[model samples]
Target: MTFEQLSDMIAVVENDTFLEAAETLNISQSTLSKKIIKLERELNVKLFDRSKRKASLTEAGRIFYEEACRLNQDYFEMLTRLKPYQGNRRQRLCIGTLPILTQYNLTARLKLFTEQNTWIDFSFEETEEAQLLVGLRQKKYDYIIARENLFSKLGCVSVPLAEDELMAVLPENHRLCSCSSVKLTDLYDEKFILMNAYTSIHQLCIQILKDAGITPEIVRTGRVESIISGVAVGEGISLLAKSNFRIFQAGQVKVVPLDPPTKLSVVLAKLAGTAQTDAMRIFADYMCNGCEV
Candidate 1:
């Protein structure tokens, strides 16, 4: 099978809709269908079960699609390595981080590395912890900065950057605002704006509460800003990392440090066996040293 066929199959599996995949590839739906059929015939395996309303990959198809994706990623990395040798002096550093950290001057922090070395180019992505780990393993990102707990099984090296304490965010006039520090016990009955289960921070929060023998009354679940906004509108109070307090405008939300404070450790992670380029080394040093912008 040709790389074109592999790409078409990967697209179909990713979009799960022939028409949508075709649209993304800028090809006609009929052509996309022909490509998939040809690929399946060559492989002697059904790539997708087309009988269903929404196309779904068969078990074998799922495995094949994963390999195809890896092949594509490897091809891109090969091209990237060769491209720089052709006088492309701009070195690219891709970083994946959590949304909360991205909101709190992460770009500005990286600016120090770029400004000092004009030949280096930087790109940043903010995504959930699972996606970040996946990208890290796939070598899509040069490095990642996320909750310290996420890198344990990803076979990456990590360096602790900061410790973020969970704080209770409430309205300025809320009764809880009168307290100097609120404990997990204090929030047991309070309506909480929480993060979704897929987020590492959310899972960490749940484990902390469970360990403390407190079951929170979850009123809503979403991203950090959503939780903070919910608190601002009096929907519910939320527990967030102290580093995230800068995301809210002054006077919009009141952030109270938690009693018996729990902290999420932040770390910078890189692939275990990958050799760091000079630019990568400099960037890592800047982050660890807390280089000023």
Candidate 2:
């Protein structure tokens, strides 16, 4: 029989009566009697003599009770020996985000949160917007930080964090690099080095140019850093988020503000209708309350 059934049998034998045993086990007398009866049926042996004024154990019950007591003691002893192995392990949260994450002070804020809440461990994936969406959809990430416009139609629960601006990046020696700001029309004749078409920045750049009725001559498409590197070597000009400019140490690349200032909204999002753990809920609230980073 089950360990619970065996324990209940032992309780009935040690207690003064069925009523006393039920009280000790915090179960009804009827329920306890039914369990013992079921156990007797399973073993095809009577555990108690109901004919007596007080319930007494049968010969078979005496043997079973002795074995149950020994087994119960061994079970507890095994648990005691294994308790040390179940040490204080922290719960982990997996987060995916765009490569521009460091541009904001989110990492510093996360460090502060982690310091105060030592029970949580964080795992981060800093990749492109396309990969972030894929990881989020596949449930490989607990949460994701990405562009709001790209994920708006995904029907996810999103918390808009901050506004970002688009800027044009050109080689330092390029003729247009000296301008205070550049318009999409001004770059009409220049070869464009763009990030992958699937990225939010790439999509936004193309849309902004189309709205201005300018078709760019795209020379290449790759990751953000690769696009920037290509621009630095005078390969072509590329557009990137304003915050991303500060982190790139390439002095050969000149970052100029976009004319008319195209702005983007960044958001922290999670799939809708999905269950969140206690830590996830707490972290989401913390981010929502002070989400400037």
Candidate 3:
């Protein structure tokens, strides 16, 4: 009911152990347990699944936790808006992105927009795509930049930014490296170390392999940077956006084209059917039309 209880419940979910969560909250285990029991009694729903050694959230608990997070986000935004009314503090826009998106020269590209609109203060968070969507829906961010194909159903207005050319990364000494370029079929039998499935590019690459009637022997999963590191060490091969070649050091890895290459469009998105702030509108216009605000 109270933010304190909601926060404690979230901490329980985060720390995985009730005792650890209690420690994190600087409360005794008995007090933490009492707070949770009171919350469940008020809500009339079981919150945690205690059967497992490590405490985990029940279905209803997950939903409640998300709402609790949204409540906190909205509260902070309200305080931020109120500050400008009380003082000379400037309102700023918050943007979220997948960490690897930074490899695409996003900082330099954003610099132009910042130069023209010096008054528009900006902050950025690098997180996973799913977390970005959750934050976007809760209005934690004015907009987020991510792969275009992943967010169509979030009820957000998406504007395509640029197409990312997909490429295969291989160890410098890999047999596939002998060829000028490799085909998807060529990798059919190879041990694949791929990007985490949370990435749109990962889903696209998986489908590509599936469509070709080729099932890559997946050895592991990781972020783009981690996947690249694995490939460089001959741990396995991976597919990623071409923009990363220059950004990531490739001392022991080789970037090669897929015979039937593919591309994923990066997009900027804002919650649909909502009034856009002046800052948000200017950013949308600049990214989509290249027109000065």
Candidate 4:
């Protein structure tokens, strides 16, 4: 009926003597006899034949003994699986970032952390600025990294990672490609490919243009690659983070620094007041060190 009673039954059958079984179980022979009696009464079946001096199993007793052994094994396995969660030794980490980080292969740097910590399962999500903030607030993601100012009103804690300098991607034959650095004012009359206005980078570009006292002719609004491909074809020049330089082919575009330089701070943001788990701390450290560009 109970696990202890089932165990006693097994010991009695295995040892073939009530006194020996009681000694093995560290209980008195009378106590073991009562437990076995209780189990037999609960099942309404005879477990052992007392006609002989040594105990012998009934057909029903053999079946119940096999089943109890299996149940005991399964219970141990379940306990092993549950121990980690019970002891706070296991963790699940969800990291979120903007597309720019993925394009630059930032996740590869976390390889060591993943390999070293076998008990922690990790997943990465790439999202836009607004969606990333929403996920962090909803507790769907543990951390997010994006262009600096994106977390301004998101009520999250932001840590600066690096200063990402904005650069101009110019075609090899473009006139400004010869200049070591291009000023924002020089692009006033130039055709430009811009990211969608809804993006944080696009908003930063708009601010930079405003500061330079010029309005760029918006050729199109789309992703970084699309803009870079347009620039490669001489359709229009575009501004991009220096990290994106690796995505463009060597001959396709020339990366020229901005004159009177403008830069955006790269930041890692997390839900405010969220406990900093070991996995989160390792990831943050990896990002801060691995993001050399």
Candidate 5:
């Protein structure tokens, strides 16, 4: 039985009548009777003799009441012992971002962050931009790094981090690989390897390709690793943000700028109107200055 029901049963045992127990528990007498009846159904035995002028407990009811009392005491004791650990949990902060953003530079910066903030614990989640916003709203993450407008539909806040231009990642042996840069039309008729729909880049790149007056052929859609792999093996050439260049390995893939560069604004997002703890504010300040570093 639930702890609530167990406690309610105990209240009944301590009082002289159902009316008295209901008053003590601050619940209606009807609700109290129903709870006891439910308890009896589960036990398949009578807990109260209804025919009595005053409510009286059966033999099984007396034994169950005593056990319930002991259980209630133990539950409170467990919470008392765990109180310290709960405080420790509150001292931790979680950050979430896309796998692409965690490339060489940001990864090194994160390592330094943890080293400097030794007093606190940190957790990280790498996922698409869509889930990052959801995590922020659900309080699954204390902070998120993603496209600026991703949180527009949400009531959360975001500090602009950096404006990164979109670039193309092509196979080393591709005809356009030798070019200094590529235009939307340059990639015409070329099969594209793209990230899943949850990623802002997926929609951004598609629209850009279509605006260049070509029907984009999406050969595949998946994680950043899969997109990079597709480009490396000549499966298809794909476009990604310049800041994410570190996620691609050299020799296998060549990163070239787009002729008409398109910039995407990155931001650090959090609950808009919430009070920030000292640790959270300090961490957010560091993230806001990402472009300076």
Candidate 6:
């Protein structure tokens, strides 16, 4: 019925399985299944054969899909032809980002870009890494600024923007605060206050601990601000990027570098095969040229 449902159905047929389609669309399998079911109910005809191991399209589905594909192509072509007629209108560029843009010092660059490019209107949505990918795939965002590890295997074009090291964040009075650096083993038995599981930092923390054969007793998980406040109040220690220390109140927490630094790479990513608009191409070049990390 809708463009999204049509696209989802098309993905299942092209990929030959609901699971593959879900992955390709950056949605859960159950969500994809529900969409297809809802779409079938609307049309009052089964789109896929349930008995097949693969997603086999029914006769009705084949007819619908062929027309859908043609319609989609015509729709895009119409938009392309109309682009030249919209004179002097501000172009819209929607961006998806992680919550740590300020910490990474990328906000200043973005602001400057906006100032110089008066003809482009920018919209930013901050969410978890997982949601960023989903938004990009769903065409909800033109681009996403996230950690490189997230889209490395997802066939996205990534331009590295910045880098920072993960460190130990603790209350000013904590015993380890006096040390220049702390090892992962030193905090093995200590209570940890980490960011939510949906964040890249949370996964990094868990992986580092696991690699070192340590089981962290994580007492709390929350947003960046909540975790920082918890650590300040001595709720528990936490691991965070070094650049993040600038955001917290001075003298409230002590941030010491990890013994062997763990680096985080933040990149500007977009769907690999998407056609680059003039605005997109210019912004990409500007950001890549201006960034040092």
Error of 2 at 130 (Å): 3.5
Clashes found in each candidate (C-alpha, N, C closer than 3 A): 0, 0, 0, 0, 0, 2
What are the lDDT figures for the candidates, one per model?
0.79, 0.82, 0.79, 0.80, 0.78, 0.83
Candidate 2 lowest-lDDT run of ten: 80-89
Model 1: colliding residue pairs: none
Worst 10 residues of 5 by lDDT: 81-90
lDDT (10s digit) by residue, model 1, range 1-293 = 77787788888877847899999899999998988888888889998887978878899999999999999878755654465465655677899987755544667677766666665677889887788888988889999988777776768887777777788888877888889998888777778788787877777788888887988778779977677778888898887778775665635678998889887778888989898986687678779887221
- For candidate 3, what is the TM-score? 0.62
Question: What digit string (tens of lDDT, one per residue) describes model 4 on residues 1-293?
Answer: 66777678778878958899999999999999988888889999998887987678889999999998888767655654564466567778998888766445666666666765556788888878778878988999998878777777767787776677889888889888899999888888888898888888788888889889988788898887788888888898888888776665545888899998887887888978888986687667667776654
- Give the winner by TM-score: 6
Evaluate residue 89 in candidate 3 and report its C-alpha lDDT on the 0 to 100 scale: 46
Model 6 per-residue lDDT tens digits across residues 1-293: 77777788778878957898899999999999999999999999988888966667889999999988888767665654465465765588998998878777778999998877666777889987888888998988888988877776788988888888888998999888899899998887789999788777888899999888898999989877788888888999989877776786535888889988899888888998997876787678788887757
Worst lDDT window (10 residues) for model 1?
Answer: 79-88
Q: For residues 253-275, could you state the per-residue lDDT of candidate 2 as single tens digits?
A: 99998888988888888999888
Q: Candidate 3 lDDT, tens digit per residue, 1-293?
A: 78787788778877857889899899999999999999999999998888977667899999998988888667655654454355454447888887655565567767777766555688779888789888888989888988777786778788877767778898999887878788888887888887787777778888899998988788999876788889888888888888777677777888998887786778888888877776786677677774111
Top model by lDDT, which number?
6
Give the Cα RMSD of candidate 2.
Answer: 17.5
lDDT of 6 at 113: 80
Model 6 ranges with Cα > 4 A deviation: 1-91
lDDT score, candidate 2, position 266: 83
| CA RMSD per model (angstroms) | 15.1, 17.5, 15.8, 19.8, 17.8, 13.4
